[model samples]
Target: MAKDKKGTKKADSSASARMSNKDYLRELRRLHVEIVKLQEWVKNKGIKICIVFEGRDGAGKGGTIKALTERVSPRIFRVVALPAPTDREKSQMYVQRYLPHLPAAGEVVIFDRSWYNRAGVERVMGFCTQEQVVGFLKAIPLVERAIVESGVILLKYWLEVSPQEQTRRLEARIKDGRKIWKLTAMDLKSYSRWYDYSRARDDMFKATDTGHAPWLVADSNDKRRARLNIITDLLSRISYEEVPREKVKLPKRQAPGGYREPNYPLKRIAEKF
Candidate 1:
Protein backbone atom coordinates (compact mmCIF):
# COMPACT_ATOMS: atom_id res chain seq x y z
CA MET A 1 0.00 0.00 0.00
CA ALA A 2 1.16 3.51 -0.84
CA LYS A 3 0.47 6.72 1.11
CA ASP A 4 -1.75 9.39 -0.41
CA LYS A 5 -0.98 13.12 -0.11
CA LYS A 6 -3.23 13.15 2.99
CA GLY A 7 -0.72 10.77 4.70
CA THR A 8 -3.35 7.98 4.91
CA LYS A 9 -2.24 4.64 3.45
CA LYS A 10 -4.10 4.06 0.20
CA ALA A 11 -5.63 0.61 -0.32
CA ASP A 12 -3.76 0.34 -3.61
CA SER A 13 -1.57 2.40 -5.95
CA SER A 14 -4.62 3.02 -8.17
CA ALA A 15 -5.75 5.57 -5.55
CA SER A 16 -2.97 7.91 -6.80
CA ALA A 17 -4.74 8.13 -10.16
CA ARG A 18 -8.42 8.48 -11.00
CA MET A 19 -9.38 4.84 -10.39
CA SER A 20 -10.65 3.77 -13.81
CA ASN A 21 -14.16 2.35 -14.23
CA LYS A 22 -12.59 -0.84 -15.60
CA ASP A 23 -10.63 -1.45 -12.37
CA TYR A 24 -13.65 -0.68 -10.23
CA LEU A 25 -15.86 -3.13 -12.09
CA ARG A 26 -13.20 -5.84 -12.07
CA GLU A 27 -12.68 -5.55 -8.33
CA LEU A 28 -16.43 -5.44 -7.67
CA ARG A 29 -16.96 -8.61 -9.71
CA ARG A 30 -14.32 -10.43 -7.70
CA LEU A 31 -15.97 -9.41 -4.44
CA HIS A 32 -19.41 -10.34 -5.76
CA VAL A 33 -18.17 -13.87 -6.33
CA GLU A 34 -16.98 -14.08 -2.73
CA ILE A 35 -20.32 -12.70 -1.52
CA VAL A 36 -22.08 -15.47 -3.42
CA LYS A 37 -19.91 -18.02 -1.65
CA LEU A 38 -20.69 -16.43 1.73
CA GLN A 39 -24.41 -16.49 0.90
CA GLU A 40 -24.26 -20.18 0.11
CA TRP A 41 -22.34 -20.97 3.30
CA VAL A 42 -24.86 -19.04 5.38
CA LYS A 43 -27.82 -20.85 3.84
CA ASN A 44 -26.18 -24.25 4.09
CA LYS A 45 -25.10 -23.79 7.68
CA GLY A 46 -28.18 -21.90 8.94
CA ILE A 47 -26.05 -18.93 10.00
CA LYS A 48 -27.90 -15.84 11.11
CA ILE A 49 -26.29 -12.47 10.26
CA CYS A 50 -27.35 -8.93 11.06
CA ILE A 51 -25.40 -6.03 9.49
CA VAL A 52 -26.15 -2.44 10.52
CA PHE A 53 -25.08 0.51 8.31
CA GLU A 54 -25.37 4.03 9.72
CA GLY A 55 -23.79 7.33 8.73
CA ARG A 56 -24.43 10.95 7.74
CA ASP A 57 -26.51 11.50 4.63
CA GLY A 58 -24.53 11.03 1.35
CA ALA A 59 -21.91 8.87 3.08
CA GLY A 60 -22.33 6.20 0.35
CA LYS A 61 -24.13 3.61 2.54
CA GLY A 62 -26.74 2.90 -0.12
CA GLY A 63 -24.18 2.48 -2.91
CA THR A 64 -22.06 0.18 -0.75
CA ILE A 65 -25.11 -1.96 0.04
CA LYS A 66 -26.05 -2.16 -3.65
CA ALA A 67 -22.60 -3.46 -4.55
CA LEU A 68 -22.87 -6.03 -1.75
CA THR A 69 -26.24 -7.52 -2.75
CA GLU A 70 -26.42 -6.95 -6.54
CA ARG A 71 -25.12 -10.45 -7.30
CA VAL A 72 -26.55 -12.26 -4.24
CA SER A 73 -29.94 -13.84 -3.72
CA PRO A 74 -32.41 -11.49 -2.04
CA ARG A 75 -34.01 -14.49 -0.29
CA ILE A 76 -30.82 -15.06 1.67
CA PHE A 77 -29.56 -11.47 1.95
CA ARG A 78 -32.38 -9.09 2.97
CA VAL A 79 -32.22 -5.28 3.28
CA VAL A 80 -34.33 -3.47 5.91
CA ALA A 81 -34.60 0.33 5.49
CA LEU A 82 -37.34 1.34 7.89
CA PRO A 83 -39.14 4.64 7.47
CA ALA A 84 -40.09 7.02 10.29
CA PRO A 85 -42.03 5.38 13.08
CA THR A 86 -45.78 5.50 12.80
CA ASP A 87 -48.05 6.80 15.60
CA ARG A 88 -48.42 3.29 17.06
CA GLU A 89 -44.71 2.70 16.78
CA LYS A 90 -43.98 5.92 18.67
CA SER A 91 -46.18 4.68 21.48
CA GLN A 92 -44.27 1.39 21.67
CA MET A 93 -40.78 0.87 23.09
CA TYR A 94 -38.10 2.60 21.02
CA VAL A 95 -36.46 -0.68 20.01
CA GLN A 96 -39.72 -2.61 19.63
CA ARG A 97 -40.30 -1.61 16.01
CA TYR A 98 -36.84 -2.89 15.02
CA LEU A 99 -36.97 -6.15 16.96
CA PRO A 100 -39.19 -7.98 14.50
CA HIS A 101 -36.83 -7.31 11.58
CA LEU A 102 -33.78 -9.05 13.04
CA PRO A 103 -32.33 -11.98 11.17
CA ALA A 104 -33.89 -15.47 11.44
CA ALA A 105 -31.93 -18.64 10.89
CA GLY A 106 -30.25 -18.85 7.48
CA GLU A 107 -30.94 -15.15 6.77
CA VAL A 108 -28.74 -12.04 6.58
CA VAL A 109 -30.59 -8.87 7.56
CA ILE A 110 -28.91 -5.57 6.63
CA PHE A 111 -30.26 -2.37 8.09
CA ASP A 112 -29.65 0.68 5.87
CA ARG A 113 -30.32 2.97 8.83
CA SER A 114 -31.03 1.33 12.12
CA TRP A 115 -32.01 1.79 15.75
CA TYR A 116 -29.31 4.46 16.17
CA ASN A 117 -31.77 7.06 14.84
CA ARG A 118 -32.51 7.92 18.46
CA ALA A 119 -28.81 8.67 18.94
CA GLY A 120 -28.41 10.67 15.74
CA VAL A 121 -31.27 12.43 13.89
CA GLU A 122 -34.04 12.13 16.47
CA ARG A 123 -32.00 13.57 19.31
CA VAL A 124 -30.46 16.32 17.19
CA MET A 125 -33.80 17.33 15.59
CA GLY A 126 -35.79 17.29 18.87
CA PHE A 127 -37.90 14.29 17.84
CA CYS A 128 -36.64 12.53 20.97
CA THR A 129 -36.15 14.02 24.40
CA GLN A 130 -32.63 14.16 25.85
CA GLU A 131 -33.69 11.69 28.57
CA GLN A 132 -35.15 9.26 26.02
CA VAL A 133 -31.92 9.28 24.00
CA VAL A 134 -29.92 8.64 27.16
CA GLY A 135 -32.17 5.77 28.22
CA PHE A 136 -32.04 4.18 24.75
CA LEU A 137 -28.26 4.37 24.69
CA LYS A 138 -28.06 2.67 28.07
CA ALA A 139 -30.52 -0.06 27.07
CA ILE A 140 -29.12 -0.71 23.55
CA PRO A 141 -26.16 -2.74 24.81
CA LEU A 142 -28.47 -5.19 26.56
CA VAL A 143 -30.61 -5.52 23.44
CA GLU A 144 -27.53 -6.13 21.26
CA ARG A 145 -26.11 -8.53 23.82
CA ALA A 146 -29.27 -10.65 23.67
CA ILE A 147 -29.09 -10.70 19.86
CA VAL A 148 -25.48 -11.87 19.85
CA GLU A 149 -26.08 -14.47 22.59
CA SER A 150 -28.94 -15.89 20.54
CA GLY A 151 -26.43 -17.15 17.93
CA VAL A 152 -26.70 -14.14 15.63
CA ILE A 153 -23.66 -12.59 13.98
CA LEU A 154 -24.09 -8.83 14.38
CA LEU A 155 -21.89 -6.18 12.72
CA LYS A 156 -22.36 -2.43 13.02
CA TYR A 157 -20.73 0.05 10.60
CA TRP A 158 -20.53 3.82 10.93
CA LEU A 159 -19.26 5.49 7.75
CA GLU A 160 -17.35 8.71 8.45
CA VAL A 161 -17.14 11.48 5.82
CA SER A 162 -15.20 14.75 6.02
CA PRO A 163 -17.32 17.90 6.26
CA GLN A 164 -15.89 19.20 2.96
CA GLU A 165 -16.76 16.03 1.11
CA GLN A 166 -20.17 15.99 2.73
CA THR A 167 -20.79 19.51 1.48
CA ARG A 168 -19.70 18.62 -2.07
CA ARG A 169 -22.01 15.57 -2.12
CA LEU A 170 -25.02 17.53 -0.82
CA GLU A 171 -24.35 20.32 -3.33
CA ALA A 172 -24.13 17.79 -6.16
CA ARG A 173 -27.48 16.36 -5.07
CA ILE A 174 -29.01 19.82 -5.38
CA LYS A 175 -27.83 20.12 -9.01
CA ASP A 176 -28.27 16.53 -10.23
CA GLY A 177 -31.85 15.77 -11.28
CA ARG A 178 -31.45 12.05 -10.63
CA LYS A 179 -30.33 12.68 -7.02
CA ILE A 180 -32.75 15.47 -6.10
CA TRP A 181 -34.94 13.02 -4.22
CA LYS A 182 -32.06 12.35 -1.82
CA LEU A 183 -31.98 16.02 -0.79
CA THR A 184 -34.68 16.92 1.74
CA ALA A 185 -35.43 19.88 3.97
CA MET A 186 -34.25 17.81 6.95
CA ASP A 187 -30.93 17.30 5.18
CA LEU A 188 -30.46 21.04 4.85
CA LYS A 189 -31.24 21.46 8.53
CA SER A 190 -28.83 18.66 9.43
CA TYR A 191 -26.16 20.24 7.24
CA SER A 192 -26.34 23.48 9.23
CA ARG A 193 -26.32 21.64 12.58
CA TRP A 194 -23.22 19.59 11.89
CA TYR A 195 -21.61 20.18 15.28
CA ASP A 196 -24.85 19.27 17.08
CA TYR A 197 -24.88 15.96 15.22
CA SER A 198 -21.25 15.48 16.10
CA ARG A 199 -21.99 15.86 19.82
CA ALA A 200 -24.85 13.39 19.55
CA ARG A 201 -22.62 10.89 17.71
CA ASP A 202 -19.96 11.19 20.40
CA ASP A 203 -22.55 10.51 23.12
CA MET A 204 -23.93 7.48 21.26
CA PHE A 205 -20.47 5.99 20.84
CA LYS A 206 -19.61 6.49 24.49
CA ALA A 207 -22.72 4.68 25.70
CA THR A 208 -23.44 1.96 23.10
CA ASP A 209 -20.01 1.03 21.71
CA THR A 210 -19.74 -2.28 23.58
CA GLY A 211 -17.51 -5.35 23.27
CA HIS A 212 -20.48 -7.63 22.46
CA ALA A 213 -21.18 -5.68 19.26
CA PRO A 214 -18.57 -3.03 18.57
CA TRP A 215 -19.00 -0.30 15.97
CA LEU A 216 -16.75 -0.45 12.89
CA VAL A 217 -15.94 2.98 11.44
CA ALA A 218 -15.01 3.36 7.77
CA ASP A 219 -13.64 6.47 6.09
CA SER A 220 -15.83 7.23 3.08
CA ASN A 221 -14.25 10.22 1.34
CA ASP A 222 -13.77 8.06 -1.75
CA LYS A 223 -17.01 6.22 -2.53
CA ARG A 224 -15.46 3.46 -4.65
CA ARG A 225 -12.68 2.72 -2.20
CA ALA A 226 -15.04 2.86 0.76
CA ARG A 227 -17.42 0.34 -0.77
CA LEU A 228 -14.61 -2.06 -1.64
CA ASN A 229 -12.93 -1.69 1.75
CA ILE A 230 -16.16 -2.27 3.66
CA ILE A 231 -17.01 -5.33 1.60
CA THR A 232 -13.50 -6.76 1.92
CA ASP A 233 -13.47 -6.18 5.66
CA LEU A 234 -16.91 -7.76 6.06
CA LEU A 235 -15.86 -10.88 4.16
CA SER A 236 -12.69 -11.18 6.20
CA ARG A 237 -14.54 -10.91 9.52
CA ILE A 238 -17.06 -13.67 8.75
CA SER A 239 -15.88 -17.27 8.96
CA TYR A 240 -17.15 -19.06 5.83
CA GLU A 241 -15.93 -21.48 3.26
CA GLU A 242 -17.16 -22.38 -0.21
CA VAL A 243 -19.90 -24.98 0.21
CA PRO A 244 -19.48 -28.02 -2.01
CA ARG A 245 -22.09 -28.56 -4.75
CA GLU A 246 -22.84 -31.16 -7.41
CA LYS A 247 -22.76 -30.09 -11.08
CA VAL A 248 -25.97 -30.17 -13.09
CA LYS A 249 -26.58 -30.67 -16.82
CA LEU A 250 -29.58 -29.25 -18.67
CA PRO A 251 -32.22 -31.80 -19.67
CA LYS A 252 -33.29 -32.12 -23.33
CA ARG A 253 -36.38 -30.12 -24.30
CA GLN A 254 -39.66 -32.01 -24.72
CA ALA A 255 -40.66 -32.66 -28.37
CA PRO A 256 -43.78 -30.78 -29.53
CA GLY A 257 -46.19 -33.38 -30.90
CA GLY A 258 -49.67 -31.75 -31.17
CA TYR A 259 -49.01 -28.22 -29.87
CA ARG A 260 -49.80 -25.53 -32.47
CA GLU A 261 -49.73 -21.72 -32.45
CA PRO A 262 -53.00 -20.02 -31.48
CA ASN A 263 -54.98 -18.41 -34.38
CA TYR A 264 -56.44 -15.62 -32.21
CA PRO A 265 -54.92 -12.16 -32.79
CA LEU A 266 -53.19 -10.52 -29.84
CA LYS A 267 -52.08 -6.93 -29.29
CA ARG A 268 -48.32 -6.32 -28.98
CA ILE A 269 -46.48 -3.19 -28.01
CA ALA A 270 -44.11 -1.63 -30.57
CA GLU A 271 -40.40 -1.92 -29.82
CA LYS A 272 -38.99 1.55 -30.45
CA PHE A 273 -35.47 0.47 -29.67
Candidate 2:
Protein backbone atom coordinates (compact mmCIF):
# COMPACT_ATOMS: atom_id res chain seq x y z
CA MET A 1 0.00 0.00 0.00
CA ALA A 2 1.25 3.51 -0.85
CA LYS A 3 0.30 6.93 0.47
CA ASP A 4 0.34 10.30 -1.26
CA LYS A 5 2.32 13.21 0.17
CA LYS A 6 -0.85 14.54 1.79
CA GLY A 7 -1.35 11.15 3.51
CA THR A 8 -4.21 10.04 1.25
CA LYS A 9 -4.04 6.32 0.64
CA LYS A 10 -3.57 5.34 -3.00
CA ALA A 11 -6.33 2.82 -3.30
CA ASP A 12 -7.23 0.68 -6.34
CA SER A 13 -5.58 2.99 -8.87
CA SER A 14 -5.28 0.40 -11.65
CA ALA A 15 -8.83 0.46 -12.97
CA SER A 16 -9.55 1.35 -16.60
CA ALA A 17 -10.48 4.86 -17.60
CA ARG A 18 -14.18 5.77 -17.76
CA MET A 19 -16.12 2.96 -19.42
CA SER A 20 -17.90 3.36 -22.71
CA ASN A 21 -21.66 3.26 -23.22
CA LYS A 22 -21.27 -0.37 -24.24
CA ASP A 23 -20.64 -1.31 -20.63
CA TYR A 24 -23.68 0.64 -19.54
CA LEU A 25 -25.81 -1.11 -22.17
CA ARG A 26 -24.81 -4.51 -20.82
CA GLU A 27 -25.66 -3.49 -17.27
CA LEU A 28 -29.00 -2.09 -18.39
CA ARG A 29 -29.81 -5.34 -20.19
CA ARG A 30 -29.10 -7.29 -17.03
CA LEU A 31 -31.39 -5.01 -15.04
CA HIS A 32 -34.15 -5.44 -17.64
CA VAL A 33 -33.94 -9.18 -17.09
CA GLU A 34 -34.52 -8.54 -13.41
CA ILE A 35 -37.54 -6.38 -14.19
CA VAL A 36 -39.07 -9.23 -16.21
CA LYS A 37 -38.46 -11.57 -13.34
CA LEU A 38 -40.09 -9.06 -11.01
CA GLN A 39 -43.29 -9.05 -13.08
CA GLU A 40 -43.80 -12.75 -12.46
CA TRP A 41 -42.83 -12.33 -8.84
CA VAL A 42 -45.46 -9.63 -8.37
CA LYS A 43 -48.10 -11.41 -10.46
CA ASN A 44 -49.83 -13.33 -7.66
CA LYS A 45 -49.63 -10.20 -5.56
CA GLY A 46 -51.56 -8.36 -8.28
CA ILE A 47 -49.42 -5.25 -7.99
CA LYS A 48 -50.29 -2.91 -10.81
CA ILE A 49 -47.53 -0.35 -11.35
CA CYS A 50 -46.58 2.82 -13.17
CA ILE A 51 -43.18 4.41 -13.66
CA VAL A 52 -43.45 7.96 -14.99
CA PHE A 53 -40.37 9.58 -16.55
CA GLU A 54 -40.06 13.32 -17.10
CA GLY A 55 -37.18 15.68 -17.78
CA ARG A 56 -35.77 18.49 -19.88
CA ASP A 57 -35.39 17.78 -23.59
CA GLY A 58 -32.37 15.61 -24.51
CA ALA A 59 -32.20 14.09 -21.05
CA GLY A 60 -32.45 10.58 -22.53
CA LYS A 61 -35.93 9.70 -21.28
CA GLY A 62 -36.57 7.53 -24.32
CA GLY A 63 -33.21 5.82 -23.95
CA THR A 64 -34.00 5.04 -20.32
CA ILE A 65 -37.33 3.56 -21.40
CA LYS A 66 -35.53 1.34 -23.88
CA ALA A 67 -33.28 -0.02 -21.15
CA LEU A 68 -36.12 -0.56 -18.71
CA THR A 69 -38.46 -2.46 -21.00
CA GLU A 70 -36.12 -4.22 -23.41
CA ARG A 71 -36.35 -7.54 -21.59
CA VAL A 72 -39.82 -7.32 -20.08
CA SER A 73 -42.56 -9.23 -21.85
CA PRO A 74 -44.26 -6.89 -24.28
CA ARG A 75 -47.70 -8.17 -23.31
CA ILE A 76 -47.08 -7.17 -19.69
CA PHE A 77 -45.12 -3.95 -20.27
CA ARG A 78 -46.49 -0.91 -22.08
CA VAL A 79 -44.88 2.43 -23.01
CA VAL A 80 -46.86 5.57 -23.75
CA ALA A 81 -45.32 8.40 -25.77
CA LEU A 82 -48.02 10.64 -27.14
CA PRO A 83 -47.82 13.93 -28.95
CA ALA A 84 -49.39 17.28 -28.10
CA PRO A 85 -53.10 16.90 -27.64
CA THR A 86 -55.11 16.94 -30.82
CA ASP A 87 -58.40 18.75 -31.26
CA ARG A 88 -60.27 15.58 -30.41
CA GLU A 89 -58.17 14.90 -27.29
CA LYS A 90 -58.33 18.52 -26.22
CA SER A 91 -62.09 18.29 -26.19
CA GLN A 92 -62.16 15.36 -23.77
CA MET A 93 -61.35 15.68 -20.10
CA TYR A 94 -57.58 15.80 -19.83
CA VAL A 95 -57.12 12.66 -17.72
CA GLN A 96 -59.50 10.57 -19.82
CA ARG A 97 -56.95 9.65 -22.47
CA TYR A 98 -54.40 8.50 -19.92
CA LEU A 99 -56.89 6.14 -18.25
CA PRO A 100 -56.72 3.65 -21.07
CA HIS A 101 -52.96 3.35 -20.65
CA LEU A 102 -52.84 2.39 -16.98
CA PRO A 103 -51.35 -0.93 -15.93
CA ALA A 104 -53.38 -4.05 -15.27
CA ALA A 105 -52.68 -6.81 -12.78
CA GLY A 106 -49.06 -7.90 -13.01
CA GLU A 107 -48.46 -5.27 -15.69
CA VAL A 108 -46.08 -2.30 -15.73
CA VAL A 109 -46.84 0.93 -17.56
CA ILE A 110 -44.15 3.52 -18.30
CA PHE A 111 -45.19 7.01 -19.32
CA ASP A 112 -42.60 9.00 -21.21
CA ARG A 113 -44.03 12.12 -19.63
CA SER A 114 -47.21 11.83 -17.72
CA TRP A 115 -49.83 14.41 -16.83
CA TYR A 116 -47.32 16.82 -15.25
CA ASN A 117 -46.93 18.74 -18.50
CA ARG A 118 -49.54 21.08 -17.06
CA ALA A 119 -47.36 22.02 -14.10
CA GLY A 120 -44.26 22.51 -16.20
CA VAL A 121 -44.57 23.25 -19.94
CA GLU A 122 -48.20 24.29 -20.04
CA ARG A 123 -47.76 26.70 -17.17
CA VAL A 124 -44.58 28.32 -18.42
CA MET A 125 -45.74 28.57 -22.05
CA GLY A 126 -49.29 29.72 -21.20
CA PHE A 127 -50.73 26.77 -23.10
CA CYS A 128 -53.08 26.09 -20.18
CA THR A 129 -55.30 28.77 -18.75
CA GLN A 130 -54.27 29.83 -15.26
CA GLU A 131 -57.39 28.27 -13.85
CA GLN A 132 -56.65 24.98 -15.61
CA VAL A 133 -53.07 25.09 -14.38
CA VAL A 134 -54.23 25.65 -10.82
CA GLY A 135 -56.69 22.81 -11.19
CA PHE A 136 -54.00 20.36 -12.28
CA LEU A 137 -51.75 21.38 -9.42
CA LYS A 138 -54.53 20.96 -6.86
CA ALA A 139 -55.72 17.63 -8.21
CA ILE A 140 -52.30 15.99 -8.57
CA PRO A 141 -51.70 15.06 -4.95
CA LEU A 142 -55.28 13.96 -4.39
CA VAL A 143 -55.36 11.81 -7.52
CA GLU A 144 -51.97 10.27 -6.72
CA ARG A 145 -53.07 9.51 -3.19
CA ALA A 146 -56.10 7.65 -4.48
CA ILE A 147 -53.96 5.66 -6.90
CA VAL A 148 -51.53 4.75 -4.13
CA GLU A 149 -54.39 3.67 -1.90
CA SER A 150 -55.45 1.25 -4.61
CA GLY A 151 -52.25 -0.81 -4.03
CA VAL A 152 -50.60 0.34 -7.22
CA ILE A 153 -46.88 1.10 -7.22
CA LEU A 154 -46.24 4.60 -8.55
CA LEU A 155 -42.62 5.59 -9.11
CA LYS A 156 -41.94 9.03 -10.57
CA TYR A 157 -38.59 10.09 -11.99
CA TRP A 158 -37.41 13.62 -12.76
CA LEU A 159 -34.36 13.50 -14.98
CA GLU A 160 -32.63 16.84 -14.45
CA VAL A 161 -29.71 18.31 -16.39
CA SER A 162 -27.57 21.36 -15.83
CA PRO A 163 -28.33 24.26 -18.14
CA GLN A 164 -24.88 24.10 -19.72
CA GLU A 165 -25.29 20.40 -20.33
CA GLN A 166 -28.70 21.01 -21.88
CA THR A 167 -27.23 23.49 -24.34
CA ARG A 168 -24.36 21.18 -25.23
CA ARG A 169 -26.60 18.20 -25.79
CA LEU A 170 -29.12 20.21 -27.76
CA GLU A 171 -26.40 21.62 -29.99
CA ALA A 172 -24.85 18.21 -30.44
CA ARG A 173 -28.24 16.90 -31.49
CA ILE A 174 -28.43 19.58 -34.14
CA LYS A 175 -24.99 18.66 -35.47
CA ASP A 176 -25.66 14.94 -35.19
CA GLY A 177 -27.25 14.04 -38.52
CA ARG A 178 -29.72 11.57 -37.07
CA LYS A 179 -30.97 13.79 -34.22
CA ILE A 180 -31.56 17.14 -35.87
CA TRP A 181 -35.30 16.67 -35.73
CA LYS A 182 -35.26 16.35 -31.93
CA LEU A 183 -34.87 20.08 -31.66
CA THR A 184 -38.55 20.83 -32.04
CA ALA A 185 -40.80 23.80 -31.39
CA MET A 186 -41.75 22.43 -28.00
CA ASP A 187 -38.13 21.81 -27.02
CA LEU A 188 -37.25 25.26 -28.24
CA LYS A 189 -39.81 26.57 -25.78
CA SER A 190 -38.06 24.72 -22.95
CA TYR A 191 -34.65 26.16 -23.75
CA SER A 192 -36.00 29.66 -24.24
CA ARG A 193 -37.69 29.55 -20.87
CA TRP A 194 -34.96 27.65 -19.07
CA TYR A 195 -35.29 29.66 -15.87
CA ASP A 196 -39.06 29.85 -16.11
CA TYR A 197 -39.15 26.14 -16.72
CA SER A 198 -36.87 25.52 -13.76
CA ARG A 199 -39.15 27.47 -11.46
CA ALA A 200 -42.20 25.77 -12.87
CA ARG A 201 -40.46 22.43 -12.40
CA ASP A 202 -39.77 23.23 -8.77
CA ASP A 203 -43.43 24.06 -8.35
CA MET A 204 -44.24 20.67 -9.80
CA PHE A 205 -42.05 18.91 -7.26
CA LYS A 206 -43.49 20.89 -4.39
CA ALA A 207 -47.10 20.39 -5.45
CA THR A 208 -47.17 16.70 -6.30
CA ASP A 209 -44.41 15.31 -4.11
CA THR A 210 -46.04 13.38 -1.29
CA GLY A 211 -45.35 10.35 0.87
CA HIS A 212 -47.45 8.28 -1.53
CA ALA A 213 -45.74 9.51 -4.72
CA PRO A 214 -42.36 11.16 -4.40
CA TRP A 215 -40.18 12.33 -7.25
CA LEU A 216 -36.98 10.37 -7.75
CA VAL A 217 -34.50 12.90 -9.06
CA ALA A 218 -32.17 11.50 -11.70
CA ASP A 219 -29.02 13.50 -12.33
CA SER A 220 -29.11 13.22 -16.11
CA ASN A 221 -25.89 14.97 -17.02
CA ASP A 222 -24.58 11.64 -18.27
CA LYS A 223 -26.81 9.39 -20.31
CA ARG A 224 -25.29 6.10 -19.22
CA ARG A 225 -25.39 6.99 -15.54
CA ALA A 226 -28.97 8.18 -15.80
CA ARG A 227 -30.10 4.95 -17.45
CA LEU A 228 -28.37 2.72 -14.92
CA ASN A 229 -29.49 4.83 -11.94
CA ILE A 230 -33.14 5.03 -12.99
CA ILE A 231 -33.58 1.31 -13.65
CA THR A 232 -31.95 0.31 -10.38
CA ASP A 233 -34.06 2.82 -8.43
CA LEU A 234 -37.25 1.40 -9.94
CA LEU A 235 -36.30 -2.19 -9.14
CA SER A 236 -35.72 -1.12 -5.53
CA ARG A 237 -39.26 0.26 -5.30
CA ILE A 238 -40.98 -3.05 -6.15
CA SER A 239 -41.26 -6.01 -3.81
CA TYR A 240 -42.35 -9.47 -4.93
CA GLU A 241 -42.86 -12.72 -3.10
CA GLU A 242 -40.81 -14.71 -5.59
CA VAL A 243 -40.26 -14.88 -9.32
CA PRO A 244 -41.70 -18.01 -10.96
CA ARG A 245 -38.47 -19.33 -12.40
CA GLU A 246 -39.90 -22.86 -12.05
CA LYS A 247 -43.13 -21.88 -13.78
CA VAL A 248 -41.27 -21.39 -17.04
CA LYS A 249 -42.32 -24.55 -18.79
CA LEU A 250 -40.34 -25.72 -21.78
CA PRO A 251 -42.17 -27.70 -24.44
CA LYS A 252 -41.23 -31.33 -24.73
CA ARG A 253 -38.85 -32.19 -27.57
CA GLN A 254 -40.42 -33.99 -30.55
CA ALA A 255 -39.96 -37.75 -30.48
CA PRO A 256 -36.35 -38.39 -31.48
CA GLY A 257 -36.43 -37.75 -35.23
CA GLY A 258 -34.11 -39.77 -37.41
CA TYR A 259 -30.77 -38.01 -37.63
CA ARG A 260 -30.10 -36.37 -40.99
CA GLU A 261 -26.53 -36.03 -42.22
CA PRO A 262 -25.35 -32.51 -43.11
CA ASN A 263 -24.88 -31.97 -46.81
CA TYR A 264 -21.56 -30.19 -46.25
CA PRO A 265 -19.02 -29.71 -43.46
CA LEU A 266 -18.99 -26.38 -41.66
CA LYS A 267 -16.63 -23.92 -43.37
CA ARG A 268 -15.01 -20.70 -42.27
CA ILE A 269 -14.80 -17.77 -44.67
CA ALA A 270 -11.56 -15.77 -44.73
CA GLU A 271 -11.65 -12.04 -45.38
CA LYS A 272 -8.65 -10.50 -47.18
CA PHE A 273 -9.85 -6.96 -47.50
> Which candidate's TM-score is highest?
1
RMSD of each: 4.5, 6.1
TM-score to native of every candidate shown: 0.91, 0.81
lDDT of 1 at 196: 94
lDDT of 2 by residue, 149-189 (tens): 87778999999988877898899988999988878877887
Cα deviation of 262, candidate 1, in Å: 2.8
Q: Among all windows of ten consecutive residues in candidate 2, which has the lowest summed lDDT?
A: 11-20
- Please list the residue runs of candidate 2 whose C-alpha ends up more than 4 Å from where it truly belongs after superposition: 1-19, 247-273
Error of 2 at 195 (Å): 0.5
Backbone clash total, candidate 2: 0
Model 1 residue 29 CA deviation in Å: 0.4
Best lDDT goes to which candidate? 1
Give lDDT per model, in order.
0.92, 0.82
